[model samples]
Structures are given as C-alpha cells and as structure tokens.
Target: MQDPLPQIVDSHCHLDFDDLAADLPDVVARATAAGVTRMVTICTRLRNAAHVRAIAETHGPVFWAAGTHPMSVADEPMATLDELEKLARHPKFVGIGETGLDYHYTAETKALQQDSLRLHIEAARRTGLPLIIHARDADDDMARILTEEYRAGPYSCVMHCFSSSAELARAALDLGFYLSMSGIAAFPKSAELRAIFAAAPLERILLETDSPYLAPPPHRGKRNEPAYTAHTARVGAEVFGLDYADFAAATSTNFDRLFWKAAAWAKAA
Candidate 1:
C-alpha cells in the first residue's frame, strides 16, 4: 500500500558522509516510509564527487549537487567552473554548492572561500542550476556578495539550512531566492529563526534535513537522516499556520521549482 502520509522532499542532506552512508539503504527506506519521496545529497568536496554521484545513480530517490564547502575551501583544490558544469551533465545532478561563507570557524580562509563561492556562482549561472548556500556568521558579506553577484547576472539559489538574521533573510528573499527550513528551525530556542521563516512568503520556503547534523526535537542531539525532514516540515507548517499536507505540498512544489532537473528526471523515470 502507498504511504498515507504527505509527500516530502529533503532538499539538502549529506548521505555521502560516514554517519548515514554506513547504512544508507535503511536510511533511504526510512525516509521513503516517512513520505520522503526525494532527497538531494550534497557533495561538499569535489574529490568525493564520484562517490556522491554514484549514490544518486544507485538510489532511485536520490539526486545530488557538488562543490567545495567553504570550511574545506582551504584544504581542497578550489572548484572550477568547468568541473562543476561537467558534473551537472549527469541527469540527477540538480544543484550547485553546499557552499558559501563559514566565518564562524573558517574565518582565516575567507578570501579563498569567497573566490570559491564566486566560481560556484558562475557554475550555477552557466548550468542554470540552483546554488545551494551555507552561510554562517558572515551575513554582511553573504548579503553583499549575493546581491552583487545577482546584479551581475541573475541566477537561481536557495539559502540551505538558513538560520541567519532577518536582514540576510530579507536580502535573499528580495533577490527571489528560496530559504530552506532545516531541523534547526524546529529547535525550542529557535523562535527567532522561526519568525524569520514566518515573515517570508510560503512559496519561497523549502525543507531540508542537512542531516547527519541538525536533527529536530525528540531526535535532537542524535544523528539525523532524511526521514526526519517530516519533523521539520511539521514545524514549518505550524510557523506558516498551514496544515501538514498543505505545507508538505507547498514545499514539494517549491523543491520542484528550485530543483527542476530532479523534477524532470522523476517525470522521465
């Protein structure tokens, strides 16, 4: 029998990482059982691109994006426009980066991170794929660079696992980019973050796990997987004052819009 639960999409996750990769089959199964029909597993290091792409190839429900993560920018060889565009050639390759500034920890590599981010932005622009951003403690530069880059030439993007300030939220939203709700938004102390999401238009909202990281309540402090996206979605529904099904449908639609390649791949499949 089909799942009676509403369909959900985990717009960002790290299934390539050891935490979930060790038991990926069961993880994917649990996500399916929980009404998560699709997931985009992010490749944070270009060196791991093949392994990440293989997971997407083998899993019917999985799609992927690749880039050098800001935190890893100094360590990894900087990603190039050609390499990112080449990766996008794969049918299930749907987005760019899990990339952006991460000043909280990697502040020393800020210059290199900015350079890598611009390369990814160019790749996103060239490939017509959504740029998946990860911002932390550098909202001013993020807002500035994104606005500057967008003005240079418009490109689609989503602030993945967004927990930034209202100003940054407004910056992204004003540029017509989406803000993804992650497990962090469901945390009890995240009322301010929830309010940032609440003030945004529902159509501009997406959902994610960023799993192997921020698991929502009940599972907080435990390892997260795609299945827990539903938990975060429920929180999103409450913030938006919509029923679960409606919120799920809206986010699924938002995912389709932002990750059109994945949506198209599903249709072809």
Candidate 2:
C-alpha cells in the first residue's frame, strides 16, 4: 500500500460558492483522500454567513470565517463591529475575515475598503482570532493600514493567498503576521512569488488552495477545491527544500497556531 500522505489544512477556501457546494460530499471526500484533513471556508459577504456557517456545521472537518470582501465593500451593506463580533461567537468561526483592500478591481472603493478592514481588525482583536487579509494591488495602503492599526493594538493575522510585493511581505512579517501560500505560488510562472515564500521563515508559512479558484499547475485554469491543496503543499515543500511530510507538518502547525479555535474544536471532538 502507498504510504499515507502528510496531513494538512486548506487555510482558506469558499466552499459555499456554487461550484463546490453543488457536490459537497464528493468534494470533501476527495480532499480527505488527498490528505487535506481540515478546511476553513471563508464567507465573503456577511449576508451569506448563514449558508457558510451551515456548511461548516454539517461537515466534520470544515470551519469558517465571515467578512465583507473589499471588492464588495461598495456594493454590500457595510459591516459593523458589533455584527462581526457576534459572528465571532460561533463555535466554528475560526477567523475574522478574508478582508482587506483589493484596489485592482475596486480602487474607487478604497476608502470604504479601508474602513471595513479596520473594523474587521478590531473584531479580530476582540475575539482573539486571526485576521484573514486579501490584498491585491494595494500593497502600500495595505501595509500602511495594517501597521497603523497594529500599533493601535496588536492582533494576529494571516495574509491569505499572498501574491504581493516583497516589501509587503516584510512588513507583514515584521508585525509577526503569517503569509499563506496559495495555488498561485505553485504555477510555472510564479518563480519570483515562490522565492518570496522561500525567503520567509518556514514556521510562518501556511498552505491553502483558495478554491474554487487559482488551482495549481497541472490543474491550472480548472476549478479548484480543497483536494488541490496537496498540489500546492508539494510545491511548498520544494520551495522550503524539505521533504513533503515535513513541510506538511510545519504548515499544519502554523495553521493551528493562527486558527487556534479550530485546533480547540478538533481536540474537543
């Protein structure tokens, strides 16, 4: 028999999205078979929190986080600190957001996005959950806001699907925040991105698929799912020059450290 693959976690994904939700059981089964033992499904809109929360409640290994995505900050009802604080009370709610600036598509809403990100940061501080950030083409502002708010009071965080500047990486790391490796880092043309991750301390790295999006090479352009996290983790091992099992263990430890609620829940189970 083949040796068991190293266990790992998909630190961020959107399972409530129709593509993955349409066939949830099979999708989760494939993830389990591939050794992705846990997944954090992110709810991008506060309105969808019920649906996302239910997905986690029904699935044994799924946990969740909720926030108003920066791209939708202008469109969706603005999120409030009280609402986010209440959501954090959920037993399976493991993080504060997939929140931050996404100026690439929504530069017009930059101010609103910054406001939302600060509220999410406050919620993360209050709940003691890691803040999940999604930054795109707003590195300067992203770094600035994170630094300013962190000075107001430190809160744990992870830059989810980090494909940003090396300076931003250094800024985040300087704040003791983690940088998550998504499928993007595993693409053939992402050598520079991979190098950025490789240069970071291995203990601060976490693995994710960010699916149903950014499926890694060999599955690039295809709809992604938690099962594909192993593909990215394999690349992470190469980037760190460690065996696959060792990389998996390291990332899993990083995940537990940031998403401690998930670890606590698993232990209780």
What are the per-model C-alpha RMSD values against the true structure?
A: 1.1, 0.8
Count clashing residue pairs per candidate: 0, 0
Clashing pairs in 2: none
> What TM-score number comes out for model 2?
0.99
| Residue lDDT tens for model 1, 73-165 | 888998888899899999999999989999999899999999989999999999999999999999999999999999999999999999999
lDDT of 1 at 209: 95
- Candidate 1 regions exceeding 4 Å error are 1-3
For model 2, the stretches where C-alpha displacement exceeds 4 angstroms are none
Compute each candidate's TM-score over C-alphas. 0.98, 0.99
lDDT of model 1, residue 25: 98
Model 2 agreement with the true structure over 1-269: per-residue lDDT tens digits? 98888999999999999989999999999999999999999999999999999999999989999999999998899898899989999999999988999999889999999999999999999999999999999999999999999999999999999999999999999999999999999989999999999899998999999999999988999999999999999999999999999999999999999999999999899
Cα lDDT of all candidates, in order? 0.96, 0.95
Candidate 1 TM-score, true structure as reference: 0.98
